[model samples]
Target chain A: MSGRVDIIGLGPGAEDLRCPRAAGALAQATDLVGYVPYLERVAEDSGQRIHGSDNREEIQRARLALDLAIQGRRVAVVSSGDGGVFGMAAAVFEAMEQGDPRWRALEVAVHPGVSAVLAAAARLGAPFGNDFCVLSLSDNLKPWGVILNRLEAAACAGFAMAFYNPISKARPWQLGEALARLRRHLPGSVPVIFARAVSRPEEHVEITTLADARPEQADMRTLVMVGNAETRLIPRPGGEPWVYTPRRVGMNA
Target chain B: MSGRVDIIGLGPGAEDLRCPRAAGALAQATDLVGYVPYLERVAEDSGQRIHGSDNREEIQRARLALDLAIQGRRVAVVSSGDGGVFGMAAAVFEAMEQGDPRWRALEVAVHPGVSAVLAAAARLGAPFGNDFCVLSLSDNLKPWGVILNRLEAAACAGFAMAFYNPISKARPWQLGEALARLRRHLPGSVPVIFARAVSRPEEHVEITTLADARPEQADMRTLVMVGNAETRLIPRPGGEPWVYTPRRVGMNA
Candidate 1:
């Protein structure tokens, strides 16, 4: 009896943002595996065996989920945002490729969700209305120089950017350095948004300009977005301004 | 008695993929506004007054929704994917910025949804599991030279890319030209994905190499994804291979 493994995204910490397909997969799951916080988002009454692991143990967690599925268990691996974006979906595929050969026989599927970048962009109007790039600033898996190089390339290309894992205790200085480098390629007036825990109760979104943006404004929970050269802001009477990038780009621009 | 406008995403072509928050907004809407095809995605029984227009009439649609909302009608403007990403949200903000001053007083919100890129990536394993860029190949809104320049920058930066509006009747040659240019910077072995109408009944996903990809393989309904150098395919016995970009990038890479 072969079972299936479903990798699902919980969608930016909001229960309402979770799609029906993902919820259905969660309800039918015989076992749940994920980081402890994401696993806690699941209802406690489902009575599924939960395998919670540290945030850094993605490979181990993926292997465990695959092993369970190989043993005829319906397993679901969860991520906070879209699992396809810097999440467990890749790790599971990696494990299936390099680990137990039986893992390949078990059915595996990925369910998409509203990624943190989309969620944050929604809250900020439409800063990503045009072409954009999504990058993770965490250098734990890659070299820091590679991150800076990509940042410069995207910035010079005039693409809006969404950054994940922007700042943490281990890498507090990287964000500042990134911003410093961006200032050379982009105008100081370009809009930058720091959105934290979007769609959750503690959600806070701050819109600022590149000239005034500080590294301390963002934390590990934050998703940062920097606009392209054409990004604009529409002022409201008494509330924060709405930010958006116009759909059209001039021939010379 | 002022009513608000909610721009919501329908999430590709699947009802099951639509989030509860968007559904709730649809249920409460007194009026709906969208392009004709997306409006058809709504249940016929919703009984809301829908203002469906041509696909190119985004600004006019945004103005109409704002006008209805300003007249104390709860309006919901729908898009097939995330409203913030090349959808009605930017158009609405643009209209509000330049059309009517009363639009500034009316409450406007953008609800996030699973975008076409994310949905396509999910259906094909995790091709966007690492840093990636999203671009539109349509030159209707931007200059063709700008598109090619951005493509080159992203390719040189080693980003996996997702392309929207890859091919249409008016611009049949752009995709082929874009691929030819990419051949200059990227290896011919890079995997390219053509996912057409993902999550719908007639969904078809094709995986090919950069060397073998043809312009005829895609249409307006297709979302194209090209992997970075490190993207790998793991073959299954009787099924198509799983495509994923590992989370790690080496120092030299």
Candidate 2:
């Protein structure tokens, strides 16, 4: 029988944020395959064969994991956040759909970890406590039109919005354009959070209003959140501000 | 100095799925408080006082945890799934926003967990591998019209959607109306997944087309995912079907 394949999430850059299931899979794996940064997360002395590949080589890395599993090796494919969220899980399935027929017969399980969306929300209180939408602003994979449509829809619906891959060196204006679209529907006072390097030592969270939010404030490492109309900021005398979205809509209070 | 209050998630009903950060908080907690089902997840011999309250008592529970923390007891506020998403974190913030001024001076931290959205996505092979929206169909807090508007907006945006609190005995027809609304914007053939009790022993995942899906198929325990227009199903010879939303949108295949 072929050995099992476990696709695991390392969570969003924190050791303790990693779930036990993912950690156990890493400890038990005969081989580990992932992007370079995620691969660095595992201990070097674990005695497991590690294959670190370039970023965006998900399909190739997935195929490598599958081949190793077919040879009766316990293989773990690692992704930074939850493997299923624009991560290795979809790439593995895509490879399996188009790769060797035997790959389909192999055992596969995906162990989810804390996603960056959750990590950012946790750091900034409960900005995602109500209805919300998550979008990737980079147009590298999807058309700009598609991203714009989703942004407009989310903005019009007044859903709290989380943007992953908000800004990068290659696509700097996407965030500005997205915000411009949002500003068309949402009030200028809507709060926006720029949660950078969440849970890591260099973590920084900035709370700003939509009108004051600048695109340059976000980078590839940052996760940006735009509050719904109902979201609020509660000030503290001695600490950072807390942001939260109340559960109700259209209630007279 | 008053003790700290940590609002932590237990993840989606699995011990291993729980994040280590939350586990650490639980280990140090002088008191653990949450909804009855989640509070029961903790081991009885853990030496911490457990306060289990009836559902809908989130504010009361938050107050209790705060009161405990103010008394110099390290308190952990537990929630199933990520606490920031429709969970205890918001309630705690609400309590702190409206409660004692001394509560604002207490230390607080939110440990992210493996949410049901991620857990269900993992079990069903990455239905949320792209842009998506998460909405609660329960109209007890929000107006039904708000839910319908957001559902229509999400559907119109062509986003894969995860619906929490999809259906309950008190409001069974909401899911049907929701599905009917999605059918109007999306193709009848769009895929929908019902992930019930994900990551637990009673876990079950059902993949069905939107046209064939019925409201009765889901319950309060289910996390329902309605895939984007591009979501696909790959049939396997030896296992259940794999569902995935391709990473790209508006791509020529």
Candidate 3:
């Protein structure tokens, strides 16, 4: 118990996906704290009890991670995907403001890895080639009204969007609600790329229209990217698909 | 050579920066084609003379790469950043569209990489937590009018902006012009983060304001990320400066 708190990124799940920097930090950690699913992503023998918590207990888990850091533990907070992207990095900072004398001495570092949004966008080529937003449809953290307001604003701005935590087993109807709102501004034929368990063993990317997207097709592992009106899907040789956002400023068409 | 031309993403600069799948593609490449600056980034010996091109010869060089691919070279038209973000991948497609019929028959895939934009944004504590756009100020192929239109749109929409190729030796005042235009809509004190040579030998980041940023402070190697109305500069305990874009929706405070 003589090291700073290191918030490590587990990349997109696979061990090979771990950034060298994230791996190095995890190797040096004595304690790992996160949700059970995220904690399971780290393979190292943590030598400390896994601090698992339900989603509502994130505040408590964050506080415990910081307290251990204050006690000079080589604490590792495991966040799947990049630590900063809808992950645990901000929660750690949220709990850091607690006025503890020992906490003041703790060093905190956020090692970034690939975000699933970017990974999903990549699989669908240029789905995010222009203005974009990453929004969570879950109402657990914020009021649904606020989500609707931001969704409307984002849609009016005409940015390609990636939805995170879009559909869960209990929240089947929220995705439909969000997509219904998207239909108000976005065209019905806007290409939506839904990638499940990206960069993991059971990874698959499905392409469909926004109007045709179904919650039955998605799960917690799915990352959905919806293209802007300018995005084009063109067929290529041998069943390989190609999608592109038209060059906005420079190309001679 | 009965192979195709593929724009492989080597990820960021480091071998570890590469995606597992992208790394697999690079290992299978028989020919590597890119500018001298980017060609040097490829680690493996593909046994093909690297297609070196001057800065002004990008169009011709891409056309040449397409020609070689038409002759059935398993050519990997390499680019430093994510191929779609101001990289040569777009140019290769342009060249292909205007090339010989045989060239159009070959398959082309644009594998995404961890762009300098993503890398720099991560270092800055996720200034892109909200809506954002990445645009280049380099007027080589784009008209100033078009560039200004997008800048105006982004600024008016209050979008966080990441600028690539903001300025070079010959284009020293481009940033000043961009700043002047951007400042007209944004507040004079909006925070600007200049990440120079990110993840490279001379890597460093500097924080400045709209009215205070000097043109000489940046060159083409730099990435300028200007935060939006909600971004805050927090003096963290680690003394590594941090900027955060508020999640905009959930302000329980």
Question: Which one wins on TM-score?
Answer: 1
TM-score of the first chain of model 1: 0.97
Tens digits of lDDT, candidate 2, B110-165 = 99999899999998888888899999899988889989999999988888999999
True contacts kept of 3: 0.18
Model 2 per-residue lDDT tens digits across residues A1-253: 7587999998998899999989998889989999887788775756888889997677889999999999999999998888987679988988888899899889999999898889999988899989998888879889999899998889888799999889888898999999888889999999999999898899988899999999989988899999998898888787788899988788764
lDDT of 3 at B171: 80
What candidate 2 gets wrong by more than 4 Å, as runs, is none
Better of 1 and 2 by lDDT: 1
Enumerate the chain B TM-scores of all models: 0.97, 0.97, 0.93
Measured with C-alpha atoms, the lDDT of residue A235 in candidate 1 is: 90
Candidate 3 has a TM-score of 0.84
The i-RMS of candidate 2 is 1.0
Q: B136-220 in candidate 3: lDDT tens per residue? A: 7877665777667767767766667888888988888778888888889898778898998677777889998887887778877
Q: Once model 1 is optimally superposed onto the true structure by TM-score, how far is the C-alpha of residue A245 displaced, in angstroms?
A: 0.8
Residue clash pairs of candidate 1: none
Evaluation by DockQ, superior candidate among 2 and 3: 2
Considering lDDT, where higher is better, how would the candidates rank from best to worst? 1, 2, 3
**TM-score of each candidate structure, all chains considered together:** 0.98, 0.97, 0.84
In CAPRI terms, where does candidate 2 land? high
